[model samples]
Target: MAFKEGFVWGTATASYQIEGAVHEGGRGESVWDEFCRMKGKITDGDNGDFACDSYHRYSEDVQLMKQIGIKAYRFSISWSRILPNGTGEINMEGVNYYNNLINELIENGIEPYVTLFHWDYPMELQYKGGWLNSESPYWFENYAAICSRLFSDRVKYWVTSNESQCYIGFGYGTGWHAPGLELPINQVVRAWHHNLKGLGLAAKAIRQNAKGEVKVGLVSCGEVGIPASDSEADLQAARNVLFDRERSEDSIDFGFGDLFEPAIKGEYPKSLIPYLPKGWQEDMKDICVPLDYIGINVYIGSIVEACEDKKYRNLKLPVGIGKTSMEWSFKPETLYWVTRFISERYNLPVYITENGMANNDWVSTDGKINDTQREDYMNQYLSALSKSIDDGADVRGYFYWSLLDNFEWAYGYAKRFGLVYVDYSNYSRKLKQSALRYKRIIETNGEILI
Candidate 1:
């Protein structure tokens, strides 16, 4: 079955991953910039100091998207770029850069879905205690107000933040990403509390400040367990893992509860209540503020089943399943289960915000990227998404994880998850085979997947 009419077809990109003019446009340092400088941290010791150079080449990127028949483009704004100090005076140059990119997408008939923040927290704010401080929510709301007022006239879809799980958990818990801080549980919960509150305040600020009617949402993803079999007990097991705890304690530290529980149930997971910082419950009102939809960035899935002990247990993946270059298991059916579960549980329209596989992709000697694996991956996952749509899932849209090969956080530029191959040496973009295939899918509104 083809996707319903008006289903948005787009590509997703983050500011720090794609935009490379980090020092230009009056941009200040971000936590990522500082973190990347630490020795023995990032793989290949590489940083996003000069990523795909999308900061200067977004016009060309938008042209590529238009040529690919995408109806929309989702990109992020770097908070530090807009407010170099993370608060106070605005950076007009940074504003102008986004204005240019947004205008280009609009001119090309590509709807713009803007994410207010995608982990590029301003360094000044990190020094001011980052998300652990009580004032972080207000600071974020202020930033949201600025963005809503400036870009709302042209952009109609606003995502308050993208993947709080990664920024909070990896950045603070595992010290794997930016602002690397391995804090105790209470401090981590403190940061988590501020982020959820920030999301609500940002949504409220955008609704009140944006120039046009807008849809505001938050993006979240952690460990999502899909039932190994569709039995009542197995389905219940999946639901338990989705809300209770992830596969392990380390995985649980990734904010599976902080991101999903509060947004859906207006409270932290019961298991995590013991670690709650003081006054955490009081912030539930703002954290549970109304959102037009929920965006989920799904790639991998864990399998779960009900045991004889009347408890759910996470089942290990069977050996020898297909895996991506990043070693992520290729489980397309994950889309079907995730969308259905989120829609049924949260009663909110679901958007597949980020879904793509990292491949060992390269422009071959003939200057062609014959990434058949990626092409098949897109086909299978999107087919599953179509199945979800048919099964009463209020699934709204699907956006490929990336438009261009970019700096993949701590993995640096080693992992490539893009439809367009970026020659890191010179910042050239070549559309891969999957990109052409995706163009056809978009042109036919996903009939190609059928």
Candidate 2:
């Protein structure tokens, strides 16, 4: 595992997914807070009321990071917590909470990689049309500006948005998330433009408030479209599997109604732009502003080539391939190609910020979680990653999906992707087998053999 100097070894977590002080510390309501309140929207009618209590347990978490020999920590800041009303007023206490966190991370020798937004939209903003509103970009920039002024001093890396395609597409189309309004076809197109524009605008704002060479990364998730076999029929199917969330036909707006469009082409396939309110091209140019690097979140690759030949879009893929406890395909080879695809298409350096597997490792009688599945999965993927880097992929760093088992969003606590096993019943955390193995990997700089 020989590698160049300055490699980043870190763990990642989102604020809403972990921090449980939802209503405490002058925090305003977020869409997630509101969404979970709806009956049955979550797996077990569960809300993130006391999620790992990371808000109070961050010191312990940071200690866990140092114990694991990690050099960096990438986490998001809760929006509503900072701006309780979503605008017009700032909470000094909320700002103090984050300042304390950031300063503490730096003092403890951990680089802080902060994400401004991670799908936890302030509930107040949702009342005014959420992402669907054209003014959302202004709202986002305002939030970014405030964050920059406070923590930009210590933070060098900032990610503007986390997986725009997933949050926008799933939240609106699938009705799985907040601001639970399903809009008309044309409106959905507006939201897409607004989100991309808002992302770019946030970056611009952060740059304006920066005092140093602050770097920004945009996070997007993907699955490789694979063909069932080498036959031309199957191979062709692989080329057009556009059902991935980003490429999907689900939209409240008309333009991106096409199931999927290739990024290289530079034009969405929906062909509904005739209905736009005009100036969409300008907005897109803003959205395409230069980014220092793109953060890619890859779980597994899919066989797109398998779905094309059949009619009715009824591609019968199996329920199982390579799976974690969450049953997501854990193919790192897909990560290699997808990194190649986005880098070649956008011609930008990339970082994998979220990549890990979940396991059904039960607690042994001695109160230890021996998660060999997770350990093996990490090795398999990292090996593929090594191959990717060797093959000339411009990947700088890789942050494991998480540091510990915390609340898993809508999935509740059912799925665990942590290297450390957490006991929710008693709020106790124990390092699992994978954590021990990973510590050695980090300490040895990934030199340990598979």
Candidate 3:
């Protein structure tokens, strides 16, 4: 069956990943700028200094989206670009840059879904303890208010933040991302709590200062636990694993429940209540705000089965299973199971905010990039997503992980996850074979999938 009518088909990109000219726009330094400077931190010593040069060529990028027939475009705003020091005076040039981008998308009939934060925290703010500071929520709220007042007239959809688990767990717990710091579990939880508080306050600020009607949501990413079989025991086990909280002080199991529960359910999981900060109960008032929808970024999942010793265990994939260039498992069923579980638990309309695979793509002798792997990958995953919708999940939209081949964070520019291939040599754009197929899918509102 085809996806439901009015389902949104789109592509996503982040500020730091796509927008270069980081210094030319009066943009203040971000934690990522500093992280890339650390010895051996990034692959090939590659940084986003000239990533796709989207800051100067966004109009051309918009044309590419228009040609691809996408209905929406999900992109993040660089916080440092707007408030150079993360807070204080506004940077009008950054504001104008986004205003132009938004107008360009609308002029071409593409909806803009703005994500307020996507881990590009200002370096100035990082020096002030970043999310560890108790006043961090207010800081985020102020930034959100500025965004709402400036762009809400044209942009109707807003996301408070994208993937808190990564920014907290990977950034602090593992020191893998920006503002790298290998903090202990207790501190990580503290930062996570403040992040959630920021999500709530940002949501409130957006709605309060919005120029018109707006829909606010948060984008979260985590491991999905799919059942091995349709049996009741297996299903229960998968659900248990998906929602399980950290069981001990040393455990770093940052699952969907940790971030989602507080924002949507208004309380921490029972197992996590003891580890919460002293004023957490009072913080709940700001932590739990009503959201218009929930956005999930799914790339892979593991099969879960019931066990005698524990509620559930994730079974390792076979040695030769299909995998992405990033080595992530190629489990198409991840979309189905993740969308179904999230909808049933939260009872909110869901959006596949980010879903795509990375491939080692290059221009062939035919002068075109034939990324058949990504094309097949999208077919399998979208088919599973359609099945989830038919099974009564409120799956509303799907956005490919990226719109252009950009700087892939810690991996640097080595990994490519874009439907539109970009030649780094001279910053040229070419739509891959999969992009053409995606254009057809969008033109047919996914009827081509059937």
Per TM-score, the best of the predicted structures is 3
1-450, model 2: which lDDT tens digit per residue? Answer: 744467788889988888899989999999988888888888888888888888888888888888888788899989899998788798888898888888888888999999998888998988898888889989999999989988888898999988766677667766776656565555666676687778878888899998777998787764455555667665444333332223334443211112113222335554445435467776765565667877877775665544433511324456666677776766656666665555555667778888888777678998778888888877878777777777777888889988988778778888888877778887778888888888888877777837
- Candidates 1 and 3: which is better by TM-score? 3
Per-candidate TM equals 0.97, 0.90, 0.98
- Candidate 2: stretches off by over 4 Å: 227-277, 306-320
Q: How accurate locally, in lDDT, is each candidate? A: 0.87, 0.75, 0.91
Ranking by lDDT: 3, 1, 2
Where is model 3 more than 4 Å wrong at Cα?
Answer: 245-248
- 282-318: candidate 1 lDDT, tens digit per residue: 8888888888888989987889898876447878898
- On a 0 to 100 scale, what is the lDDT of residue 335 in model 1? 89
> What is the alpha-carbon lDDT of model 1 when measured against the actual structure?
0.87
Candidate 1's C-alpha runs over 4 A off are: 246-251, 255-257, 308-311
lDDT of 3 by residue, 1-450 (tens): 577789999999999999999898889999999999998889999899889999999999999999999899999999999999999999999999999999999999999999999989999999999999998999999999999999999999999999998899889888889888998877888898999999999999999999999999988888888999999999988887667632667666677878888889886877777667788889999999999998999986989898888878878788899999999999999899988989999999899999999999999999989999999999999999999999989989999988999999999999999999999999999999999999988988888884
Work out candidate 3's RMSD over C-alphas.
1.1
Q: Please name the candidate that would achieve the greatest lDDT relative to the true structure.
A: 3
Candidate 2's TM-score: 0.90
